[model samples]
Target: MTETHVPEKLKAPVLGAVITVSDRCSRGEAEDRSGPLALARLAEFGVEVAHPVVVPDDIDYIRSALQEALDAGARVIVTTGGTGITPRDNTPEATEPFIALSLDGLAQQIRLAGLAATPLATLSRGLVGVSARGDRGALIVNAPGSTGGVEDALAIIGPLIGHILGQLSGRTHEVESADE
Candidate 1:
């Protein structure tokens, strides 16, 4: 068999934003743990997180926040909360119009990982997608609102960050083995 080699593309370090969607949190009635949790997790990967925001669980509000983050040069927007099976949960619906592609596998993996910790994970309506904005072309992903859910989702996505960035920058290569 012939060996195949692919060059890796260089991508600039991109900015990110963490948006926590909860009515109480937006109203300053409850602490916003999910947003902070997401920021900390992303920081571990050396990603710069811009200002995080707490918004009510409203579709229009979430949509506006996403647009603002993208306009502010955030290449990745991770939203926590409003991804449940409730009447007020409208994250997926709000984000649908902004996505260029839906990353079902990522969301599925998150759900599966969350399931290991709680059966309620099956009810999570988290989603992942690429934003439709022409300039930013960012990847927008929605994860569960709880701290544990945020942790699990990031754990699942952590290993793929480099590859995703490579892909976004128009490079494809076989990831080097850990033993190497």
Candidate 2:
């Protein structure tokens, strides 16, 4: 596996979470592949998965999972599922309240990257943002529920993950050493 090389300025490795948001998956009615798939991809990007949560499509459940991940000091949190137009699709809504700043480009890039494969990619309502709830808030991003979607999203995000998290934590600049 070719590991992603995070910039030198980023000294700390990413401690991350993957939250699977689907009512069926949450209830054991459907097999979840996206969450686990995303976690594996993240490993190649040098993000250490610290939490993996499965929550229903309900807004509260999604928010609770995000909150728990943040409390655990996750620097990056990626959620899959519930990003559609259906009545049960509430992941974006669930995420908005917790976000202090929006990273619209992250979601847009995912959609744009997938557009070549499927025009329906525009229908996803996923979001990306930062939550300043802790001392070093987490960078939160959402991806489509399908395994393919997770693959595409991760491929696009892998190169940018370190940069975004470094910015979120104000650590993009390399710290000077005593002799350097």
Top candidate, metric TM-score:
1
lDDT string for model 1 (1-180, tens) is 444444332255568889999999999999998899899888776567866799999999999999999888777789999999899999988888888888899999999999889999989888887875344578788989999999988987755665666566565466555466
lDDT of 2 by residue, 80-174 (tens): 99988999999999999988988798789899877878988899989888887344877788899988788878887777777776676565455
**Which numbered prediction scores highest in lDDT against the true structure?**
2
For model 1, what is the alpha-carbon lDDT of residue 121? Answer: 95
TM-score to native of every candidate shown: 0.87, 0.85
Each model's lDDT comes to 0.83, 0.83
**lDDT at residue 46 of model 2 (Cα atoms):** 81
> Any runs in candidate 1 off by more than 4 Å, and if so which?
1-12, 132-135, 174-180
lDDT of model 2, residue 107: 85
